[model samples]
Target: MGDIKPLEIADAVLERYRSLEIKEPDSANWTVIAGIVAEDTRSKQLRVVSVASGCKCPGAIVGKEDILKNNADIIKDSHAEVLARRGFIAAILEDKGLLRSDVRFHMFSSSPPCGDASIYEELDGSLRFTGAKLGDWRRESTEQVLGKTRTKPSRSDSIYRSASLSCTDKMIIWSLLGIQGAFIKTKITLSSLIVAAPHPKLIHSLRAALFRGILDRTHTFANEFCIPPPDLSIHVIANHYSGPAHCTKTKPSHLATAWWLSSYSSVERIVAHTGRLLGARSDSTKHSRLSTNALFELSDSQYQTRSEAKINSQYSILRRRLASRLIADFPADHPRKRRLLAHHFANNDIDESVDMRGALPLAKRSKLSPLPAYLLCSLC
Candidate 1:
């Protein structure tokens, strides 16, 4: 864990990705790739334990009502970062704290994450004329009034999942709350986070987009909720010709992949298209176990013993506080508060908030209440 040689960690993941020969994506179809590498406590050796590549989400095809209602087991967000984390949790559940602490964990991505990290409203060659470096582009964004949070961009004609936060924001939350997951009732975080594509100019912006934005905040939350930021760096990936932006030959493929190295069983991989397994029959129970619903139901019924019983982890309190930020505004009961929250969230542009009609309202801006978990993830 002490000063990893970096490139090899990223190279291992990239090699793992390139080695996958399933329904591999071609030049016309691209996808984002991300992985979690675990460091051996003794040998200090690095090995990739979990990896995922995807862009589609379940909320894309199904109606918003279906997703929020928990009507079925559907992968909530198929973005590589989220799915990869989901797969990583499988390791934790199998053996608690096996790789949850700073003593051993690293992350890698084939592309810069979307949102604050990936966006730059800068003109090309600006450095040649104005002497502004690429790193200064995001720093200058504050004055342009571009600080508003952005949802994951989707150009598909169909309504995609806009309710969830971008991968960048979620990763920041993970850094704070540990990717061990809520149900696990335990805490674990990344030691380092590395993303592909060498853009030395974007260091400042990438930091702000990754975890610096959260760390730079002045909040009233307890110090226990704060954790040291992961080692963030950039590396020039080999043969990383597939990304949503950097590669024009390949468009981001809707199909997603979730692959995890099982501690007990053989390696498992889930390849999904349009949110469901490829060629899965309608009657077959082929839902991705990593989906939100599956995590709750399956963990409760089966993997309960694998998780520690400590529900009062700093992250648990933080999640409640997040919900409380807005929930505190109303002293009323749950149902009524939800209705009131709809209005509070209406102007906030939170896609997760829905009124009685199960439809999103196009309302103008006003105020924002921090409805933690889903809300904080989306807005941040």
Candidate 2:
């Protein structure tokens, strides 16, 4: 990481994102792009391992084991950052060689992630990030509330709202639990998190956001989990594609995309990942293989669940200790926020810090189900 330039990595991600076929799906729809970029030691250049574009958060799928196993699309969290991270893990799970030999990895997003990090103020009539270091922009900002975790609503007028955490918050949790989510057993570490910065204040705000809120109260919650903060940087890239303006004429709110580096390239509706029209039953097609569950290996120890017919209804833990610690770590000021995070994350606080009598069963149960619900570490 010391030798690598964030600029090189950022440009590689932007270039790869631009090369995608579905990038220009429609003029009316513009989606945020985020992905994991890696240093290709063999080619001595940076390459995008995986990238995705979207703003949909189907959070209920996190606990719905039945839906996860049966659905072909199986997109529980459709934010570009989450999908891209999932794609990188999927690619790694398929080929272990990708992570071998000290190959460095970095996460790049087209814009500042949502929630606490994106808070800003008008400077010369343009929005500039206000939070920096230990600053508390949440209380000062007028557009959004400060305390407690927030949800990125699906739409303004919809009767229901999306349950997904903003990309910024998700990254904070990901740093603690590992981006593998419920997919793999091993942990993959990133060198740094880079966001596009056309100026300086945005950089300051991004720094404050990660240091202050990788998902809020970075000091209290993260320290308990023992996870380090992601190295942060901001670079001026040749292009920062933020997509269309908000409230523009679009269909279905907007069209989001999920894709990765695979033999097949089919961008189907979220309801139909097998390259078919919406509402149609899935088929024996290429995109079906791209489903998150399809990418999982059930027989392998890395796999989270075992659904082989008469086999026991056994699930596995992806980050047992981390889950336990985070639940225990939330500050007293925000009791509800802990539950909010726990709703999606697993909880298995059965380590030395835990009282096994109460936490052990939950830990066991978490390992028994694909979605057992749910952290921060301070050396970060």
User: Which one wins on lDDT?
Assistant: 1
Per-residue error (Å), model 2, residue 50: 0.4
**Tens digit of per-residue lDDT, candidate 1, span 78-193:** 67877788888765655454643435778888766665455442335332111111111123333222222333444322133344445654555565556776556555667677
Pairing residues by index, what is the TM-score of model 1? Answer: 0.68
- The positional error of residue 301 in candidate 2, measured at the CA in angstroms, is 11
Best by TM-score: 1
Q: Each candidate's TM vs. the true structure?
A: 0.68, 0.65
> In model 2, how large is the Cα lDDT of residue 345?
38
The C-alpha RMSD in Å for every predicted model, in order, reads: 8.2, 8.8
